[model samples]
Target: MFDISGREWIEEEYLRLHEQGLVQEKDVVKVIGVHNQMCERCLNQSDEWFGTFTYKEQLITYCRQCLDFKMVDNCHYLYRSLMPAKITDNAHVLNIDFKLSSLQQRASDFAKEILEANDLGLIWAVCDASV
Candidate 1:
């Protein structure tokens, strides 16, 4: 089951991977065990080793570079760190739906634009889809 945000869910998966030896403890980069506490990306960046906790299930390890950008508002990495409930009032039900809708619309619009563009080729098409 998922918590308020998708990040927690990913953390849980990381922990499982750690326990299974699919990921080492050193693979995690940052951990903010506290609920709603802001993360310190600079401090987090100093650490080279990380492992997700089986109980907490969030990234517990990160290098300085990754951590430095973790808290940036427009960063895609930061978006990954966001907990669903933290971003929305009704995470499990309402907020996720809203976010998905927004993402789908963006994807649809981008696809349409790509299709309409004459100069873009296969490689560019794949990159566009990733965005």
Candidate 2:
């Protein structure tokens, strides 16, 4: 079977995978609830970005932030495969010919720390408009 871990799909996609025998019913996991005040996919917490609609006599809530990519809402389920027991660690090397400034070096070091811990971190750097 193909590796589906670290991937998220919709209900229809999961059903297709099941029909293809790539994924079993027990292997699928629903990650979030419908009518969620916050969007689990995009982490959009703004209430104004969410909308409700009637479907089959049921009110369904959806996240607009990620709607362009896929319909993320209560009526549809976000499916994910179960994580593997052991994950292999690979060395991630940063290849830069030029030396980084002190500020950039600090950000790079911080990113490495968070990545080693398997946590989320964002390093925002604004380049000059002229560049």
Candidate 3:
């Protein structure tokens, strides 16, 4: 039986983690359950172990086996990866063993040719499409 205050505190921490790239965006989505009123990943196996979080005067169910996910009754749930992004020791090097696919290589080659030729229209890569 958790209180609403505890939920708010945890959510604030989650938001902070999201800002620091330790979690997904602060907006976690609820995956509607189909059959079981349990965590989609863990699917509570009647272990009789769990935690509760109060949301709007209702207790949101959380599984003990898997904590990163939560369920609201059997129909709704919110999920976020608890695992944080990996940080390499060398910030300059991203991946040591990385291979590009044939199609990707061709596209890269085409872009390189265009850049080398000083083309007026250069293909731009959009990394973050937050809008």
Best by lDDT: 2
lDDT (tens digit, per residue) of candidate 1 on 1-131: 33323342135555665577655444344444322322333323222333233324544333323332232211112213333336445432434332335556665566667767843322122332422
CA displacement after TM-score superposition, residue 5 of candidate 3 (Å): 37
Which scores higher on lDDT, 1 or 3? 3
> Distance from true position, residue 84, model 3, in Å?
23
28-82 per-residue lDDT for model 2 (tens digits): 6786634448777677789888888999999888888677767888767788778
User: Against the true structure, candidate 1 has what lDDT?
Assistant: 0.37
Per-prediction TM-score, please? Answer: 0.24, 0.62, 0.27
Q: Global lDDT for candidate 2? A: 0.75
Give candidate 3's error at residue 27 in angstroms: 18
lDDT score at residue 75, model 3, on the 0-100 scale: 30
The collision pairs in model 2 are 34-74
- Tell me the deviation in Å of residue 51 in model 2: 1.9
Identify the candidate with maximal TM-score: 2
Ranking by TM-score: 2, 3, 1
Q: Each model's C-alpha lDDT?
A: 0.37, 0.75, 0.48
Question: How many backbone clashes does every candidate have?
Answer: 15, 1, 0
